[model samples]
Target: MSSIPIRIPTASIYEELASARTTPKTVTSIHEEDGSILDYTERSSDGPSMPPHGLSNQALPMDKLSRAQLIAEQYIKDNKLLKAHEELIRCVALSKIIHGDGHWRLAKAFADLAYSYLTVRGLPVQAKQHAESAKNILLRGVDMSKSVEEKREVLGTLVTIYYTLGMSHLLQNNGRESYVSLQKVQKLIADLEELQEKTSVLGKISDKDIALALGRSCVLQEKLSLAMNFFEQAVKMVISSEGDSSAVLIGIYREMARAEQMKGRHEQAIHYLLQAHSICQAVYKKLSEKAAHTGLLLAKAYAAAGRSEYNENTNKYFTESLSVYQIVLGADDPQTQNTRVEFSKWLIQIGKTQEAYKMLQEAVGSETEYSETVAEMLSIMGSIHLADGKIQKGYQLLKKCLEIQTAVYGSQHSKSKETQNLLTALQKSGASWE
Candidate 1:
């Protein structure tokens, strides 16, 4: 994540706003790693000529704010995210002291702090709170701006705030709200571009980011056409800016494949998956985990393409994926085991129950922990045994599946209940095992 610099142009409008309020609306506190709490409240009028609790040894508030901003930038560059987050908190407190609560500068500080929470700490809830606070302040301050520089600064801060807010909403699975927030960001960026008469706006938030986010939001809302359109726009933009061979295209192609599948355009979906698989083969090593994963996706896509004639392609990719996964990721890795389970299920679908059973036995032998994957494997194995009239073995496997499901998903979960019902039916049918 890039650091957004706080630039405050000299203006009497801001000066008047800064002096209109002495105290900020809320008190901010910082918790240190050593279990120390630093209160960043405003100093009383009659207090000594020193700073706040943790900043007593620092310079004046303005100078300290500048230093804190610089330190935060350095911390981010050094990948010290936790320390950078702390410094951003200090910047918020110092901005309140220097620019008051209602000034655009303070809003910019909040926007930066909000972005840090989202990008650096992956805390979307905190990001949304600070982004909303910034928006509130900016809404009140935007009308007072007169100069071009001030307008540019305000618009830049707004872009960051809306982008952060949109991503926060998306993370929380509020698709409609996320689309609304991202639309605001897109409009703000367009306005900024028009104001400058330039192709590039002055922020880290790009058109591609907006397009991809809008696409994801649309996908969540089941707006498949709009989602595909946005994804296509993003694809064109990325290809125009970065070359065709850029690694970013791999994910976009996979997303496009998913959208096509959702729309029941199986051939189109296969085309996109082929593109993604090709990219994976070229960008990563031939036998890399990424290549293996892409092969797995391609195999599943072929199997789901509603054409039994594509069984050859499906089997080829499945074997390639399994081989690479067993070599690169260990045979006991969750992903490898899951891939085995998926392939075994496909085998059973093609009427190769004995082959599927052997694969399931290998997976079960290596599984050391009780997980959803293990439970699924056991269930399938039990069903295979029951179909072969091995009642005693089937009963034992299903009983273990029931125990695992209850332990992992609780006894009241649908999976556990289903397994319980199956066991009951088996007993009621007079199937005896000793």
Candidate 2:
């Protein structure tokens, strides 16, 4: 492949910027218009909390939003996305307001903020909107009034914004647009590479950017083999860019494992996931959310390995997934319980009905779990128990299940009627919900 030429930022430039950025950012305490600290939103384990990084809060007439953004940046450093979103939005809004609406600088802020949301919020739609805003602003032509450094900043923002747009398109199932944006990314990477080749000092930054673009592109293309290679490259670049000290290496390693899994290369996936798991465990103690998530991914890789390796180990991985999920989300969180319950079914299939029964009990009693989702949990439990000769116990659980169904959707709810019929049949067989 013909490597692109790109110039890396001068060491002096980074040193100066680092010094400037080191100054503790001033945060406006309040938004005059709403008394809501110029931040975007407040805490809600349920809804949007704060805007993440890359937002401009300068538009709010006050620095409150900037303050919020600062707060969000710290939270992001701590890996608290919800809190970061709250502050990042404030930061972007304030940046935009201060810089004037839709100004390139402000657009850059929006683009960065959107990037955080796409990765952390699990909300791609909103992320796409913000990235587009950035691209649109840069499209208006660079403001010549700005210095070279300023113009370069805008160009950099455009690169990231386009990357975000490409990923968002993939998530939205818009393959065509995704491909277009990816091509643009590739062109940008090539251009950056060329510049850095000529100016070797810029190599690190340019390589980091190129690796990110290539890794994402490969993953979206379903080229898992290539994706793994690019992701490894990205990890190396990330390490170099951040220096040997990194608090986030485990995450990238996990992502690398995911790419390998997509290729159905279980052995490699397990290797990377195990490395991720080890890093997460040592770096993070106390069953940290980060560790739990890494464990979850590792478990999935192990489970997918099926009997190709150790059957006992595979079961252990599923159990570990359930355990980690329970610690983070509690027993009732639908996603957590669902995982445990599903694993339980698989256990039953392997003649572990006794273990499955315990998981079922947890699923039934969990308030945090969605009770009305009988289509999977309840029905499956009912069938499993009945087949295993626990008819009476199954009938009772199934009755409670029906009552829950009827309570939310009325007795006429199709699922409810179906369960009711099952109960009726059970009665004829001399069985009881009690």
The model with the greatest TM-score is 1
The lDDT leader among the candidates is 1
lDDT of 2 by residue, 325-348 (tens): 788778666667667765776677
Model 1, runs deviating above 4 Å:
1-29, 32-58, 197-203, 366-368, 432-434
Least lDDT summed over 10 consecutive residues: which range in candidate 2?
Answer: 1-10
Please state the error at residue 332 of candidate 1 in Å.
1.2
If scored against the real structure, what TM-score would every candidate get? 0.85, 0.62
Count of clashes, each model: 0, 42
> Model 1, 1-434: lDDT tens per residue?
43332222224433432442444332334545455554444443555334343354323568768878888888888989877877787778778878777999999999999988888878788799889989999887466347877777788888889999999999998989999999998888778877882244444567888899999888888899999999999999899989887778889889888988898888898899888889899999779999999999999998887578998999999999999999998888889989989899888988899999999898898545689999999999999999988888988899999999999999999999998998899888986554
The stretch of ten residues in a row with the least summed lDDT in candidate 1 is 2-11
